[model samples]
Target: MESVRVPLGERSYDILIGSGTLKDIGRHLKGTAFWRDSSARTAIVSNPTVYKLYGDTVYESMAEAGFEPVKVIVPDGEEYKTLLWAEHILGKLLSAKLDRSSFIVALGGGVIGDMAGFAASTYMRGIRFVQAPTTLLAQVDSSVGGKTGVNHPLGKNMIGAFWQPSLVWIDTATLGTLPKKEFIAGMAEVIKYGIIRDSEFFEFIGKNKKDILNLNSKALTRIIKRSCEIKAEVVSKDERESGLRAILNCGHTVGHAIETVTGYTRYLHGEAVAIGMHMEAHFADMPQKEVARIKRLIESYGLSTGLPKDIDEGALMAAMEIDKKALRGELRFVLPETIGSVKVLPVKKDRVLKALKRGG
Candidate 1:
């Protein structure tokens, strides 16, 4: 087991990574300040699918540890990540008569974490929560950063809050049950950490691609720990994404557009990000050799590096305009300058259109 700390002063938390950590989640949450003084109550927010797999274990463990646990199951899918679902979770919280002292446990993937965290943040002007992310995408990225929210039709993660969590417990054992396509999608964010700031980690992934895909325990632990460290470091410096943190959205600008234009159902978040990185690199005129290398790496993980053939160029362009990174309605992309470095630059919409046409 390994732990990385997000040093946010009063809001600081630890991300615990290991193979069997889920079995200890009850004890871990009990150790928090929130659970120290009373019979701590927690609502385990999960999708029906995930709950079916690990619900009993989580509930039994919490009960044995003397904490009250409630199950709140939402439907599984990106389409359900909406205010409507968030309100549903809020209703559950209210029905339970959970007080401001109670915290929520987001026990599923990114969707559950985002919506549940958003609910906790807005409930009674903000409450505490813990993230027990079950998916790779959520484990390495969404669960650690404290950026929580549901999606908007205009863009992904459009309506959200910067509420930090009290703890982030990641059990690598959960990945063993992930579908192949979802696993491949997660590699996109892992690849982003390498492209944005860690060249050495990029090479490490290239060297161990086989072990990673094979689900070698050592390889999985190494990648998850390193990814969390990089994210924790970045978030500690820029907690609210005021400046340096924007770089973390390396592939997300075009990626979110792809998701919105495709109605958030066709491609997984990681898959859309893979294609986004490819198109944005092309638009930024990154080195051809590097671009090819990125595409090959992404393909090696069973992810696509190109836009959907039926994508609407007009809608794609329109989505980019509303991206959170845009400045004065201009498109701004996090362009890679080398293997380990990227810069944010604003480009013309027409130029982006030309790049999209070429990609098509």
Candidate 2:
């Protein structure tokens, strides 16, 4: 087992990563300051499909640790990640009469984690929550950062809060049950960490792509640990995305636009991100060799490298205008400087439109 600490002063928490750690969730929760509070309570927010898969084990773990958790299940899908679902979950918490001392345990993928965390942040002002991310995308990205929100019709993650989790429990064994495309989607974020900050890690991913695809325990554990560590380090320095954290949204600017234009029903978040990274790299005039390397890496993992031919370029540009990172009227993109470095540049609308029109 390995752990990374997100040092956010009072909001600090440990992200525990390992195989088969789900069974130990109870013990781990007990070690936190939240557990020390005698009035503490925990409610798990998950989807029906995921709840059927591993909810019993998680519930038992919490029960053994003295938390009589409320099992609040939400409908599954990116389309369902809306204020409506958040309100529904909040209704459950209210029905249970949970207090600030209580924390919500998000036990599914990014959708559940985002909604549950959002609900926690808004319910009766604010409360803590635990992120038990079940998907690779959530485990490596969403679960570590405090950014929580549901998708808006105009933009993705537009309505959210910077509510940190009390603890991030990552059990890699859960990946064993993840679908093939979903696993590949998660790789986009893993590669994003490499592109935005760690060139060596990018090369490492290329070298071990086979092992990672095959779910080799050592490879999966190593990548997830490294990804979390990178995110933890970034979040620690800029918990509220005041400055350095914007780089974390390397492909998200274009990626979220794609997701929104497609109505959140098309590509998975990471798949859209894979394409977004390639698109942004193209727009930034990155080296051909470097861009090719990134594309090869993405395609090799069975992910897309560009937007679908049918997507409306005009709509994509429109969606991006409403991006959370956009300041004033400019669209700021986190463009690659090299294999391991990036800069946030506010490019003109015409340039981005041309890039989208170029299409992959």
Q: Which candidate's lDDT is highest?
A: 2
Tens-digit per-residue lDDT, 1-360, candidate 1: 799999999999999888877778887666766567643667889998899887788888887788888789899988789988999999998888778888888999999999999999998898889898999999899999898999877556789899998888888888889887888899999999998999899889889999999888889989999999999999999998898999899989999999878877888889999999888888776788988887887788888887766887899989888888988988999999887789999988888998898772
Reference-based lDDT, residue 151, model 1: 81
**Whole-model alpha-carbon lDDT for candidate 1:** 0.87
TM-score between model 1 and native? 0.94
Candidate number achieving the greatest TM-score relative to the actual structure: 1
Task: Give per-model TM-scores.
Answer: 0.94, 0.93
lDDT per residue as tens, model 2, 132-167: 999999999998879999988865678999999988
Count of clashing residue pairs in every prediction: 0, 0
Model 1 is weakest, by summed lDDT over 10 consecutive residues, at: 32-41
